[model samples]
Target: MKNLLIAFLFNFLCLCVQGATLDFAFQLGEKQEPRLDKLLPDVARQMAFSRDSKKLIAKGMGGTVVKWDLQSRQKREISRIHAKRWFVYSIGANQLLVRDADDNITILSLGSGDETLLTNGQYESGSLSAEGTLAVLSKGDNEVEVWQLAKQGPKAVKTLQTSFPVRNGLTLSDNGQFIAAAEGTYGDGEGHRTAIEVWNTINEHPIKVFNTGEILGVWNVLFSPDATMLAVDTQKNAQSGIRIWEVETGRQLLMKSGFEAYWTRALAFSPTSDSLASGGEGGNLRIWDISEGESVIWETYPTGIQSLAFSPNGEYLAAALWDTTIQILHWGTSHER
Candidate 1:
């Protein structure tokens, strides 16, 4: 009877290990290959999805913007704007934040083509909220400037002072109440350390700090739609590790490795905030079950992925590839093992 009981315990442990290593499958519904490199004179530099996920917009190097209807798979050129060092960071509420040749920031209205000046001078780095209502700009200092964007104009509302040097990849909450930024430094010595700081704009205080030990750098930082979770992709030991945390309690919930560090630039949470989609070097696409802490690697592409977005209904996922094309993937029939 003692030997039998020991054998049962060993079997149970093996079952648990198998369950954790199981791979969930994702159905590839359709790959919308725009072939932007052949169609346009210049390649598409960035892409964004509409709020409802019915449409997608791609911005090219020559200031040409094209909108595609996901249902029909048809596309048309929408607008054109000239800029020397241009970037389409955010698009929502019919507005896009861009930088002009003179290094000045402006908000361009998508409908009327009217431009509103945001900052007269150039900023070292900045991030615009997905809702297009809030923006955070850094000037290579310990402080970051927050602006409230509106149809009438842009107003400087608050300045977030950090305890450490502010790195790139600033993320602002959609509600304009909180901002998350990567702080600290990277080096070969023991003195090097990195941490992500979350600040409260309303009360002008720092709320939470997540320490990332011995990572070379952090590429991206994102807050969930409900502001309950924060996810970041960092480089550690020449590989990439994605970490997710509970915002309120400052608890690290999950950490996983196996992605290339240099190209892991995309991370998006599902609408229900139960799953997260990550894509990066080697065109590896994965969806992580947040609650279970298990992941499903759907596919690998020839090139790396630049960005990822989940539809509002959480039915489809959009992956913007480095080769200037996009893929639309649907959830498989069965996600549970």
Candidate 2:
């Protein structure tokens, strides 16, 4: 059975080749099979798997939140807050960081139904560290503030300023040692110039600046789990794609194109950091080899994909689809046979 699964994965990787075939295989072990978790009546737009990978938390379009038990295959509504827009960052062991429609950010306790307000005013965007220990908030002033979500309250650590206005993307490294934001501006005659800035949280100094010239916009920015690479989803006049950069040297590692920005904004790096997965509006999902920039692509659904996440143990890839469903695919990595 194991060998058959491995062979199936090998054929999956060899289904298409552009530059060169990847030398690795993403396997599906005998333990878990790829399955689709349906979200009926509620349409999920934001999602995050529990750190332990035992549960999945989803927020619907109308502000309904549900927690699904992976083992039992059951779901329960946790909390519901009506808002025009919402954000779900990280799901901790007992708490979740979320933002309501009015831009009120809070840490909600799953056990007691209690809420701890991190901030009350309006902010451009926010992100939480993987462990939920740190949070970063970006405001209109092009200043990104690092906050320590202490047990008592939230404390401002340091602020990192960007070169241009923060148009959209903002993310923090899991270790909370670094923060990244997308900076760009539209000029009268110079056109649109965009750049991604990474800052050291300790000294509030910019460590690396990736200048993406004349792009329409940068929609999302993410740091790899190991904090060694950064990925940005960019849209240009003629094409759109994702760009990856080496964190230490400020070097662009890869630029993968051919997908429309409107549909392919969701990106997630594998736990091993050797590959990446992206989902698109056309329900297309592509898993790309980081080094070679080749991918195994497939159409996941008929509707668009809104978000993507990987389990910490590298066992499952969860994608939130526009058709009101969360699809979880069992994934494992093994060396070339």
Candidate 3:
């Protein structure tokens, strides 16, 4: 009977493996098998997949940071060093940055468990590069500051000043060459902001100021893996849209509209930058080819997605949901029954 059970499991996994051949994101209307539904200490405000792939770090506004082993699913609390009211600002290969209640930045090394203070005024929003060498932080009003996280500590690298007020968040390219800033002229109740500017970190100047030319706003800003493209999404009731632009020319490469972005936190490009996946307020997960515009290639369940991150090898997508559960979409294999 044990041998028979083993044979059944093996055959089931093989069938699931065949199912995984389809691009998981593009499998519209297909049931998305839950790979890992991890519970968190608190509602995850944001989460990141470490480049090392050994750890998955998640944090919430309640000043809790939890680290879980991607393979073993072992949970460990590492929120000992953050401020009273802190939010995870950025996650690097082996480091984590937090914004404390006092509005200062705390850089923590995962290996040594050492906390380094980076006092550079009040940083409300920030992004750390993949290499963990550079950080871009934003103050109250569209004042973006860049710092170098060198061996000595974080030092002032550059400053980017914008004409409008910052609306949502700031994102830095993996190479740390470009920074995207979301600025708002006005905000509304249902998550509406204004335009965004992609600035070259080299000179701290805006390369392009993007506006939707309609009654919409750009919220989350992200750069493609190769750093040749920038993507931004708008959030509102019945006025959802996502756009991708050329990095050097600021040309609109693609634009897809008519989706629900309200209360949805899904925007991540595959590690190869060939495709993009987004989860919406309506609990729908969609994937699109970067080269194709005005079309969705695939979709999945309507789970209220709050945040998303891709594994270092690009095999899995970790989604932090509004339901206080972290769902991992392992683009391949069906180890869960």
Candidate 4:
């Protein structure tokens, strides 16, 4: 009987391990082939995949934005704004936001190519809400302003005042219910601390602030699919970790490595809200289990990872890297090994 009981325990442990291993099964999806040497020179600072994930919008070093089709593998130059440093800060299927060195925001319609000046004020960071209803722009030390995007143009809706100066990272929830702004620095500094401010657009008041002392600098923040949790990256102390916080309770549920010491450049929550994908320095891409606080999958390449996105069905993951290449990865079915 003692031997039988021991055997049962061993079998249980084996099953647990198998289940954990089956949680993440990764495969290669579509390959994005871009003519790096001929089409563009230097590195890509920002990239946005179209709403249907069929095309990509990339902004290179010289303020040039190009639209590339994945199916036909064709590339078209969208914008060649003559600025000291031009960047397409945000992109959507219908619209694109370009920022120049002079601190001007230009909203361009992809369909008509009509350009409109949204803001002339200098902004350190900015992001468009998932629904495209609001555009949040940050300026100077502690000022954040939200602009309402209408059919005509953008209008300032609300403004937030922060306690300290913020670096360039801002995220909006898909439902347009909350905005998570990263407030801090990347390297050694006295005010290097990570704080996530969750605010409601209706009330225009912050619901809660998740502060991580002075050792961590919030690099990026993302909301889960259901908008129930918040994921943020801390870059100070030569450490990078993702902390999951309950939106309602402001309680931290899990904290997982954000992939070595490299800064987490982009983060995306899976459609099912069961996992998260983060891309960062060292060309590393990592996926973590939301509930288990474990890294279920990871991949490394030659170029640094700049952005990441998960498919609507949660079956595929897409990454935009510094090597001027976009990669699509397939999530395999889970099974016992």
Q: What's the TM-score of each model vs. the native? A: 0.78, 0.82, 0.79, 0.78
Tens digits of per-residue lDDT for model 3, 130-197:
77898877874958888898887679876789867775678889888888887776546534447778
Clashing pairs in 4: 63-86
lDDT of 1 by residue, 15-96 (tens): 1232222122131223345342443323344556777667766665555666668877777776455543334445456566
Question: Which prediction has the highest TM-score against the true structure?
Answer: 2
For each candidate, what is the lDDT?
0.67, 0.71, 0.66, 0.64
Is candidate 1 or 4 superior in lDDT?
1
User: In model 3, which runs have C-alpha deviations exceeding 4 angstroms?
Assistant: 1-41, 82-93, 187-193, 214-216, 236-238, 261-263, 294-297, 300-302, 332-337
Better of 1 and 3 by TM-score: 3
Which 10-residue window of candidate 1 scores lowest in summed lDDT? 20-29
Report the poorest 10 consecutive residues by lDDT, candidate 2. Answer: 25-34
Each candidate: RMSD? 9.1, 6.6, 7.6, 8.6
Error of 4 at 75 (Å): 2.0
Model 1 alpha-carbon drift over 4 Å, by segment: 1-46, 60-65, 76-78, 82-92, 129-131, 187-192, 332-337
Q: Which residue pairs clash within candidate 2? A: 263-280, 263-281
